[model samples]
Target: MIKRITAGLLAGTLVLALAACTATVPISPTDSSGLGSETIHVGIAYDSAGRGDLSFNDAAGAGLDRAKKELLVQATEATTEAENDQARAETLRGLAQGGSNPVIAVGFLYATAVGTVGKEFPDTLFAIIDDDSVSADNVVSLLFSEEQGSYLVGVAAARATRTNRVGFVGGVDVALIHKFEAGYTAGVRSVNPGITVDVRYLSKPPDFSGFGAPDKGTAAARQLISNGADVIYAAAGGSGSGVFEAVAAAPAKVWAIGVDSDQYASAPEAVKPHILTSMLKRVDNGVFQEIQAFAKGDREGGSKRYDLKVDGVGYATSNTALNRYKDDMEKARYRILSGAVKVPSK
Candidate 1:
């Protein structure tokens, strides 16, 4: 069950903060492409760092962009910098009230907010990413098998590491991020039971600033590197940038693995060579599919899982450095897909 936000916590200060921090972008509606005559107005409520994070939020934005072009839908987006539930609830309410159907909330943090605002607007459809706790007829949960993808990256890291040591830097110490850690550790140990795997989280729950803070990511990566970790995987959202920076600056050749999007493609030239690969979460595909389903007149709400078999989650190959591990990664992928390997999500 989803936890309900306390009614008394909706303070005036939160309202003011929401107003000051929320920025909504409105896209002009165009003719619906073959779906129907009705213009589908989609709205997205992003987590912290919003569109420019070049990681999670950008992946969602890519889906919105596809909807705009392929589906010919008008879109509006609002981002919430505040960590509290009140601000997130208001952002969703604003979008739904403005006639945006199938409002997409970019992160699992919006679960409670979606539950609250979803009740108020029964007619409006709400799609939330990374969470499946909201039990509402009007809500659709977009989830991914992050562990499956993380496992593949872990295999790559273990195989590429010369020091037989690797590290994982998570943004927050939450169950969601724990899945990444669990799968990574299992993958490392699977390759070599004696391999040392260092793990660190930037922040804990109720203080999600870790996802947006690059400095903490740098500190964590530096600490792991000092301990002789040659390959590090960062599931730290915007903080992953710092991890890349830290790896690139190391005196010895070190590899960095990114999460969510293809970090190697977006990384700077100096950092590109250091990025081994990224665990592609395919959030963009989830978002696009949700909107596409609604546009096709399927309004039923339920949980949709994007896993390896569906090509929903996997690792990137943009960096040629991953060539040596291609055969091994493919074998691992086949095993996971064929049910020969069970990746843990804890």
Candidate 2:
């Protein structure tokens, strides 16, 4: 079942820091026939990883970049640090007040901030990724079935493990991330009830560094490896690189799985060989589609969901380790799609 929270962030007054402008890519319009004559100003308030994390934030950035190239758009991006939820409201407010019609907020952590600010800006449409609690008329919630995809990678980890033991590394201990852990555990059990799955979280609430700190991820991965986990799947955003590093440094041949985007295609050459697969969450497609709808004068006010049935989430098969299990994975995917298998969210 999908866990829903109704806590509103409109009660407290938030002090927002100035949005640090990291990068801005404005495309020159070459053709007037694209989309429309008026230029759409798109604004994004990014998560802690920002653009270079090669993970969640980068996926969001890819969507914005695509919109700028294909449509007549002037885009602006703002970066956020770990545990800076207060600043999210100001960032969105600034974008709307500065003429950005539809501002996008990345990450589920922005539920409170988006709820609070979205109510204030009823005219300017707001879209938030990974959150669904905000019910304002101007807010668009873009949610993904992370558990469904996480389950697929769990199967990969189970099939690829030689020690009959695997591990899961989560960025934080929250309801949103727990879905990943729950599905992974369920998938591992489905593969082999006798197999052991070791789970660890980098940090708890109020300490969001678990998603951004590579060293912590490396430490968690090493610990899991020491516990005889030969296959480790990480859903820790940018911190996932640390899991890759740990796998690379291990004396024994171990496998690692990535999240959000396909790490096999984006990881460094040295670590690429160790990545078994990735839980592909199509945040890029979701963001790009939402922008396209807005550009076409279609404003989304309700929640937009992306799942396996709709190709919003899946497992990456670019890695050699997972390539051999292609048929089995496809069968499992079909089972999930056909309702024969129900992946747990919590």
List TM-scores for all candidates, in order: 0.91, 0.89
lDDT of 2 by residue, 152-249 (tens): 87877778888999999999988889999988888888889888989999999888889988999999999999999999999999999999999999
10 residues in a row with least lDDT, candidate 2: 1-10
Q: How high a TM-score does candidate 1 get?
A: 0.91
Scored against the true structure, residue 296 in model 2 reaches a CA lDDT of 68
Query: What does candidate 2 score in Cα RMSD to the true structure?
Result: 6.8
Q: Please give the clash total of every predicted structure, in order.
A: 0, 0
The lDDT per prediction is: 0.86, 0.82
Off by over 4 Å in 1: 1-34
Tell me the deviation in Å of residue 17 in model 2: 15
Q: For candidate 1, write residues 1-346 as lDDT tens digits.
A: 1122233433321221111112223333563433555668788888978888989999999988887777777777777767888889888887777677989999999999999999999999999999999988899999999999999999998899999999999999999999999999888878888889999999998889889999999999999999999999999999999999999999998899999999999999989999999999999999998888898787877999999988889999999989999788898999999999999999
